[model samples]
Target chain A: MKQAVEELRRQAAGLLKEERVKCVIGWTQGTDVARAVPFFATSVRQAARLTWTPFCVNNLSKYLLNHRYDNTPLAVVVKGCDSRGINRLVQDRQFVRERVVVLGLPCGGMLDREKVLRVVDPGAALQEVEDRGSEYMLRTDKGEYGFEKREALLSKCLECEHNIPVVSDLMIGPQVPSPAGSGIDRFAGVRELETRDPAVRSTFWDRHFARCLRCYACRNVCPACNCKECSFEQAVPGWQQGACWLSKRNHPGQNYLFHLIRMFHVAGRCIDCGECARVCPVNIPLRELYRKVMKDAEELFAMKTPGTDPEEVPLLSTYRTDDPEEFS
Target chain B: MLVSRLLEYVGLEPGRFEMRWISASEGGKVAETVREMTERIRKLGPNRKMRDER
Candidate 1:
């Protein structure tokens, strides 16, 4: 892990000094040991502050949309999941492929902070974490402790589609094997929901969406949501008679409406990176909403996973006459 | 309402929507109408509504 971090810093510095890229987007240690935040490095000297850790959870590809046309080229550090996001934007024609350099960083998996907290004593100050192949050892004020990878891994990482990258300008780190049957049964959660009685399913979703804080973290982190004027975004006071279908109310019905509409908006485009579920404070099974759409698109239209190929047109944007029309 | 909402969500051709009812005794007409609709839709190509969204 240390060797990979050293290589990343050296590469980032080289890119900035040589004018290969205008900026380098990577991860930096967060204020807390349990988190790693996104870092933007514009100069070679600032590159030293860059890092690669098991805690680097953010996708980092969403940052690329803002740099779409800053004139000079930009580079973004990406993990396996994030590369799918880059593919999404490029496929959507959001950004030209030549403008952004992709630095694919290999990731074994990421640990869930909540799981880590459960293993450690309350109020213990976390110090450092050592990544052993099978488990991660955490050093805290209370004492050193080790947790197995499976028990500590984030739900998103357990079913990781790829640990290296399908596409990369530069690749680093060792490959990690994906959990078996995870790819085939990606829609298992959605299928479970399908089996429930209509009333039970209604209650299930109602119970979850009722807790939403309307924070918009899920939409903001979503790579598929590239709208310049989102329907859910708050409008400027009185300038227009629109901009929010969600009506500012925090009613449970309104919350359910907001989530359902947002999910439908990104139906065909969602790459299933699971960033929305990761960032949600209320732990909504938001991925299941999009996954249902993804599953239907695959089965009904015979659509493959989005962003896996750059040339294929998006499913919703293009359709075949032979498309299955169950409702029709 | 749900069908229109779906069409708007995907930003597909709104008027491309089609519905026709044939009496239960007229299975041949239903099959013939479906074949004609398929040909027309295939030639129209993909929806332009998706590209022109606000």
Candidate 2:
């Protein structure tokens, strides 16, 4: 992993020195050892700051939307999950493949900071992280700590389908085997919810939605949510002919409507990056809601996961004559 | 069809929501569908899930 970091920095610096891209988006050391925050490298000196670690979990493809109108080319570092976001943007026509360089990283898995803290000292500065196949050796100023991947990995990483980037202009490191097993069922969570009574499911979702702050962090971080003007952010006056679909009140009903509408809007388009659930402050199992839609789409239309192929047509956007007519 | 499934997933009564296709010439069918839907909805009572309390 250290060699990959050095190579990543070198490549980022070379790209910037050659003037191939106006900016390179990657990750850097965060305020704490347990975190890594997004970094933009606009110069060779800044490019050298790029680092790769298990904490580099953010999907950086959503940042391309900022340069959507600008013609300047950009380079972004992507993990397996983040790479799917690239396909999502290109397929949605929100970005051009020709204008950007994708640097792919084959990820084993990302660590859950909370889980890591349970084993390592919270205040210890993370000096280095070495991947040891099934476990990670963390060298900190305090001491060296070993974290088993199975116990320390984020919940999403446990069932990751793509350990290698789906799309990339360059591969950053040698391909690492996927952490998820072939027998892992991606829809297991959705199936569990389905088996529950409708009343129980309703109560469960209601409890989660009631804690929503409507901060829009999930929407902003999502690559599929690339609309220029979101319906939730419409500023129509109260007396206007075109009224807003939802009121600004923080009522439970409004929250329910907001979540349901969001889930519907991204039904077939969501790439299952799991950013929505990760960014939620209230810990909503948003992935379960989205996966339910994906599961149904598979059962009904035999559609593959979204963003797996850029050329494939979106599921809901097209219809077939043989489409199920059970509802009608 | 997707919307119906989504509504059901959120605990809404499946009978409260229905989707049907009727041509303009099928006025009789449209009326019958509406009557049937209204009866089912009435039996299911008011929707308390997403209704605002204003």
Question: Model 2: clashing residue pairs?
Answer: none
Residue B14 of model 1 has an lDDT of 39
Q: Pick the candidate with the highest DockQ.
A: 2
Q: List the residue pairs that clash in candidate 1.
A: none
Question: Runs in model 1 with CA error above 4 Å?
Answer: A120-133, A137-144, A179-184, A234-246, B1-54
The DockQ-based CAPRI class assigned to model 1 is incorrect
TM-score of 2: 0.97
- Give a tens-digit lDDT track for model 2, residues A175-248: 77787866888898889888899989989988988888988888899998999988888766662344667765
Instruction: Please give, for residues A157-276, the per-residue lDDT of candidate 1 as tens digits.
Output: 776777776668988655555532344576677787776664566667767877889898999999998877677764778634544455756767667667777877787788888899
Candidate 2 — which residues are off by over 4 angstroms? Answer: A238-242
| Candidate 1 Cα deviation (angstroms), residue A235 | 4.1
TM-score of each: 0.79, 0.97
Supply fnat for every model shown: 0.02, 0.58
